[model samples]
Target: MERKYFDCLIQAIDLINDGIHIVDRSGKIVYYNAAAKRLDEIDVDKAIGRHILEVYPSLTFDTSTLIKVLNTGNPIFNIEQNFINYKGDKISTINSTLPIIYNNKIVGAMEVSRNITEVRVLSEKIINLQRELYETNNTSVEKIKKPKAHYTFIDIIGQSKEMLKLKTLGLKAAMSDSPVMVCGNTGTGKELFVQSIHNSSNRKNKPFIAQNCAALPSNLLESILFGSVKGSFTGAENRPGLFELANNGTLFLDEINSMPLELQAKLLRVLQDGRIRRVGSSNTIDVDVRIISAINIDLNEVIESKQLRQDLFYRLNVITLIIPDLSKRKEDISILIDYFIKKYNDKCKKFFNGVSKEVLDIFMDYSWPGNVRELEHAIESAISLYDGDIIREEHLPFQFKNFHPTKNFTLDTNVIQPLNTAVEKVEKEIITSALEQTDYNISKAAKIINVPRQTLQYKIKKLDIPFK
Candidate 1:
């Protein structure tokens, strides 16, 4: 290529967020962008013209994607590769390598790699957190202080038809020992459902532990789930994992989709045999722990994305509960508002009697992406901000004050639809329009529509609203 064209190409590739690496047919590094250098921890001046294997000693001709593509004249798309650099620092990446052919002759290979080192680090930290949360000695369980479960089915606030159906299913599931999976958007009271089930289950008196899977990584998560032996690794002590700690009780895994795929396979094994093998132990121990898992996203989407293992999903999904969005249960919003007003009234020592009609209309029209959690926060915000007995529109958050309906739809006069059907259609259209306006930014869209972000998120999930 010409010098200006080459420079232009370099600048264009440099603009990309992911690493770009290119090598000649001879496996000599020809191009390495700044992103590639940063991701691979290599110097651009030194890497260009050097052999691929020379720069990354950990990779061989057989293992290197660039070399494989160059020799085979075949592309390797979206494959995860892990290697250590010359400095012995481990790097993980998802790479797409393609052969650069000229005149039907393989001339070189180009690789696009995205670094996932932070994900690995995050997972490791999560494992450590799990160990701390479920700390236990080999002989006895560690006494980490945990709050007692205060809310049961009675505490589950909504009484809408959908809510009633969900509660009925939850109560029935609580009677059994099978794994349960609860799916809903954020702030949909997933923990409340899990707590209610635990409180109602036969294992209510026993330990009822809950942990968010996103908080830890796979290796540490594994050690925390299935106890670790003293010599499992350096500083590894005889610690009982969550499974052992919650034996004959309930273990609630929140955001279960966040658990690593490989670790999920192990979880499936444990569920199958009612047995758990410590991180580095040979013997298997039996633990009759009822598992309850929750996910903020659609389970099908998670499974398709390979975040949640299919078999494990099926196991946990033997009994599944899909929580309704706040929009679908709008009837409960007034009740919830009243309940929260009383709640914050006592906590903040205020005498707020109710919300103004204008505020109520805004609440009804708003799409709560954050669901109940968001609603509670909105009420609390208004209560804390206002001194008067009534919560006026001015006391509401800026999101509500600046709220604007994105669109208005009119049903064809020639066609008549049922009142309920027509109302649902309008609701769906309004939400869909807002999502498009904000490019599907739940928080922004929620604010635009004067509802909590979680409530809006729940509506999206419940209404099957799709966005990129």
Candidate 2:
């Protein structure tokens, strides 16, 4: 009894967190642990002192795995096997094998395993969320206001051909005193280009001011651009306008096409004559401010519609620079992807291995309507949703399945078909079928039509199609 007690105490010294097992030279299981037989419903006492292969004769179970690690003097990790249970169902498990060394002699080896079935299931969910986020941001990328930053010309990234072309035009425009007009799709970094021009010009040291003409009321905009004398209507205070502050520098106007028609006439005079009159003041202020205006919408169309003054359009459009959309610049996507990934990773204080090839392939496929701004947010969201050390296909957001930028260069198939008089035509046939399916409720009918509610209402009014 005392001898058996001493043996148990000696064996207890070799116990470890990881499961341990010992086999004799003849391959007999002399000792094993409760943890070793954890997967099976077998009794640990019965599992002990049995032939290793005969003990757990499950499918794909290898007796030689531990022997191999023992002989190699190295550890084997993450070996996968579908172990058939007593009821004959496969259970996923990952095993780690390590050699046991005793006084410079190879004894036996032990194996440890962990179940990863739950983790695989969770990864599927994270991938789906990643896709949903990408789709949600795609439609609203431009409408959201970006966080204000103190970035200047140097902060603008890229030396790509498209950006360099804009830079050359900007440099030339900045050298001259002509009013500059920058045209681009919304969120194409128009402000960055404007600041670049200002930084390159001789007026680099002076104050550079920027404002969106479309974002403010006309009365407030007038005071902001042309200054306001004391007692100039409500919130009256003596203050310098953008023209005064930007004297010897540049004043950048964003969405200039949205500037009210009445204000455009006043802006035209300021451009024609380098003089501006303060509100409620008779004296004209002599300011040498350079003018730079940006518009996503074509000002010529606004001029034709009489929404903008023709004279003001011509004056501001003297030197025009059109920024190509992100879809047009496919070569820059990879560089920009890495840039934003690194940016957000540092800002969020998370570590993510680079995106998998599958994810990169999807990114290359998407048509970016919202331009660079859209791409940046998509990358940020992907990184936030990624689970593993690396971002994979599951890590990427959706819309990539159908996204093709090169295909977007061609004619858009989703184009609205003009009014169809006959019910036999495609548009008419589809709409009538949708309306019939919806039972003729206009609200429900418009959703069934897959067209905008406002558009469907206009079509109904135009075609005299009755809907309850």
Q: Pick the TM-score winner.
A: 1
* lDDT accuracy of residue 163 in candidate 2: 75
The lDDT values for all models are: 0.82, 0.65
TM-score for every candidate vs. truth? 0.67, 0.53
What are the per-residue Cα lDDT tens digits for candidate 1 across 94-139? 7899999999999999999988767655544655665565556577
Which candidate gets the maximum lDDT versus the true structure? 1
Summing lDDT over every window of 10 consecutive residues in candidate 2, give the lowest-scoring window: 402-411
Model 2 lDDT tens row, 180-239: 888888878888888777777776766566777764445556766786777554224565
Point out the worst 10-residue segment of candidate 1 by lDDT.
141-150
